[model samples]
Target: MSEQKKKIERLTGVKGMNDILPADAPLWEFFEATVRSLLKSYGYQNIRTPIVEHTQLFTRGIGEVTDIVEKEMYSFTDALNGEKLTLRPENTAAVVRASIEHNLLYDGPKRLWYVGPMFRHERPQRGRYRQFHQVGVEALGFAGPDADAEIIMMCQRLWDDLGLTGIRLEINSLGQADERAAHRRELIAYLEQHADRLDEDGKRRLHTNPLRVLDTKNPAMQELVDNAPRLLDFLGEASLAHFEGLQRLLRENNIPHKINPRLVRGLDYYNLTVFEWVTDQLGSQGTVAGGGRYDPLVEQLGGKPAPSCGWAMGVERILELLKDAQRVPEPDGCDIYVVHQGEPARIRAFIAAERLRDAGLDVILHCSADGGPASFKSQMKRADASGAAYAVIIGDDEVAADNATVKPLRGAQAGDADAAGASQQQSVAFDALAEHLIERMTA
Candidate 1:
């Protein structure tokens, strides 16, 4: 291939991943800021773990037989020490492993939040990517239904803060490990009867985790799942009470939810209170966020059996929902654009722009050297495109008179624009352009 072609190919992002360009930065800022503020209000602290961990950590914490560990992990050996490592497919397991390694569990209950990229080797789809971003929260050491309720409430609060609409919460309890195991046996027996009709993947799931049959996308398998044993029927007394208590809390808080008995999560670690936030805006991949209780996960990863619960939401999926709902806000733009004419005027414009920026206003200083008087119109157009609320024009005439011309780019009616002509420009005494711009922008 030619060098030009090679350069073009190198510029492209890897498949199933994207570069979040300047245009998308504002949306990201809004989403992350809203989530961070909400998490802080709920008394959760931020915790960041490594992007890669020992491969065994996930194998033990997320389950070796599960899709994330068995099929989707991006694992490789470290070049330095030859230790096998894998990019995290999810945060809960890595966070659990961090807690164990650092002995955070001994310090009592901890509420933590994390936001970053997760890698999984999977076919790219509309809402699915090989690499994705997730904002998640983990509440560890609390084992009762109250902790579960708090996590659910936090999610609701996050959605409200983001001004998200038309989302439904579907929740279910998978009961304790033993109860799930008993239910799994009965589910396998049902699958055995329909073995001939089962797809290869479904049959494989039957031998490993028969409960996953209910999570199948196949309509034929779904028919079988509908009549299969419901986990709710097999919940022990304690598990039943825990599920009821969670429902009561939701009622008291006025959080609308539906009890979905077939909502067992795809992960093997989840033992109770698996839930998902779903919307109809996205076609088949409607689940924006979901997680549940994984009480034994920490212990399984060499921790002292610390109970933990958490949830993760896909950033891309949420962005899609926001776009479909027309909820994304317009980007914030420069507050002031400084347009200068002559070389001397350019220096003055730079100084004035600095003053405006120091006063907490965003100022864009134009320093092009090629244009003469004709550049004024082009500079004004650039200022307009910058979405600047105001423009400060400094030309040879203004600089000679030791004055500056400030005009409102927006928030001016037709009459106001006419009244505020060249003569109407604000006259700042000395180098007080910053104060003048601050007052005008705020107004």
Candidate 2:
């Protein structure tokens, strides 16, 4: 192989994909941890499914005409066998596939949640990546507007807890399949009247999925789209009642929302209530999370008929908003840094580090040796950079004496010699190190 080609191949990641470096991980952890706790409190049991699924799952689940299955999915055939597999474009299909294959709905309702990477071949931009992460929640069975409202409420709680502002809740109902079919015929007829003004993408979807045409971003087609037959106006008795019940529930609970007639889920399976959480803070791409009822997906995926409603939030986009709003906190690092000089001190430091770990403290052992122990000044610098609360300094004299120097690194408690402005050191016996750290950290 050419050296140039080999070097190029080794140095770069796939375009549009990204790595979450150490500094970026704390925000991700905070978001994931918060979502986990929220989901757990709402009685959601997490279910993990494969990243690769049969190609038909998405085609049949998300619809072949939708942008996901049509243009953006990453699908390929296995070399060993000819079976086609796809890196999931979105996880709803896979989640539903798993639920059906396992007969999760056989007995009754199941509230499930999952968080993972999803693949989509797309132009990368702010808040958008080819390989992105999402948090998906599916409340299978218990078909009611209550399920829809519950998911919305959970999303609200998440934003409130995260201290997010300017995130708007916009909702609409796609009605039932029959209502949508009727709407489609009317929408297509209306679009045909102004086909010359429709954008290329809009015209392409005119017949295949006319509802998405109403969701156009083209300025030239705004008037045309705005005047297009509204889906909300076509809702029948049951669909109207369901949407009304959802609105009533939200109002009773004091959750604010705007009825966006133009709002429609990109997925073909959605029916009844569809909602999106949007914010103007993120330029152009304003949607942070969205989903709606997909009642027939369970049966469509080869399981007995079941009604399901769910939503998925883009982790990157939400984090982007949090970052733009300056809400992401710096990651907390080790609780203690273990620094030692000389052989006896090194050995004692290792043992003490292990003890600290066993006591549930995070410790960064000053491990590199360029010929001898790192200088005390250098070790202290590393401890500060580690964001640690304390540094445990052991030297030959202290090791021989069975004692160590405990130094405060940051966030000094009042009245301590270090509290007013500077760090201070206190002598601590070897055995009391763990207890001292625990007490100090807790304080």
Candidate 3:
């Protein structure tokens, strides 16, 4: 036998799971920064919860009959202890659980937001992944229809901020629990009459989650589903007034929307106003963001009956749309790069970089992988590729003189770069490097 054992095969990431490469980091950062700013401006506080929660949190909060609990959840027994654990499929339930457990609403209403990864067992597609990121907003202790309207307004503002296009809003109210139950009785009766007309999946959900049957994409079942009983018709007076109030608010704000009777939201906890922003841009799986009032969810999850309204946007789907529409801007690289020659020059380059960074400038220090220094030509190429506007060159001569040669590598055009170098190139002293770079950048 050989003295060395065979190497183990390299393992790959799980299917439907993906790695966010360096190329995609810019867009992710831009999206996150924009959302964080927007949510904060509107009086929302950020909250975080663990990615894994007790499986019962979902089964109880999301509803036992829902598809999330029945099929899509990634649940397993904790190996150390026999406790059942699950990778949260949707975060709303977890958010509600945290709020209830912590009594966040005891002081009054709380406008909270969260951004994190969620897992689900589903077919991996262009915009869907087993491990995906979501930005969720929750407003608790507010029962007014105004709260629902404000949430939609926030959604529209976010789309505008992202410069996204082709998204259209559609809304429908689920009314009170009694109203939905009364409609369910009629809906089931109607579906039972035409049970043979439903698709296999539709038929399966018909008895358990008849509201979801309306969301089916099966062409053969569309005609029947379209003509099925709509919950909008059975709304009580209070429900109608609440729905009208939301409509009036959207109209006043000039936020366009269509009333979609089929928009019940995949979650069973939603009651009263439910809305979704969909786009034809994402192929057949069109919804990009959606949510509504889950008035009973807090109480259902063990809190004193507190009203809540919230929504979540899928990061991948929205990014896909922004990418397709060419709305995401190309990420700019560092503002400056320091390229050096001698060991002493490299040390000086490191000091210059830190000085620039301390001055609020982003700087990239160039180093060759071979442990030997790279030639000036090679360093220049790297500086240009790094998207740095200026390359501060510190050669043996410049290092000995205690100064650096500031070279402009990028400008509006090639000619501009040459012109900038001709006009701005200088041997900047060690202490003046940061000030010199700032002056050149502004100029």
Predicted structure 1, TM vs. truth = 0.92
For candidate 1, lDDT tens digit of each residue in 332-416? 9888898888888888888888777777888898855565454888998988899988789898888888888887777643126
Per residue, candidate 2 scores C-alpha lDDT tens digits across 1-443 of: 65565444558789889989988998999999999999999999999999999999999999999999889999999999999999988888898899888888878999999999999988999989999999999999868999999999999999988888999999999999889888888888999999898888998998888888888888888898888899888889999999999999999999999999999988988999999999888888899999999998988989888899999999999998889778888888788999888888889999999999999999999987677557888988888888888899999889878999988877644226744665467889989989988997786
Q: Whose lDDT is greatest here?
A: 3
- The clash count of every prediction, one per candidate, is 0, 0, 0
State the weakest 10-residue window (summed lDDT) of model 1: 413-422
- TM-scores of all models? 0.92, 0.94, 0.95
User: Between which residue pairs do clashes occur in model 3?
Assistant: none
Give the clashing residue pairs of candidate 2, or none.
Answer: none
Best by TM-score: 3
Question: Which residues of candidate 1, in runs, are more than 4 Å off?
Answer: 1-10, 369-374, 413-424
Question: Model 3, stretches more than 4 Å misplaced?
Answer: 1-8, 412-424
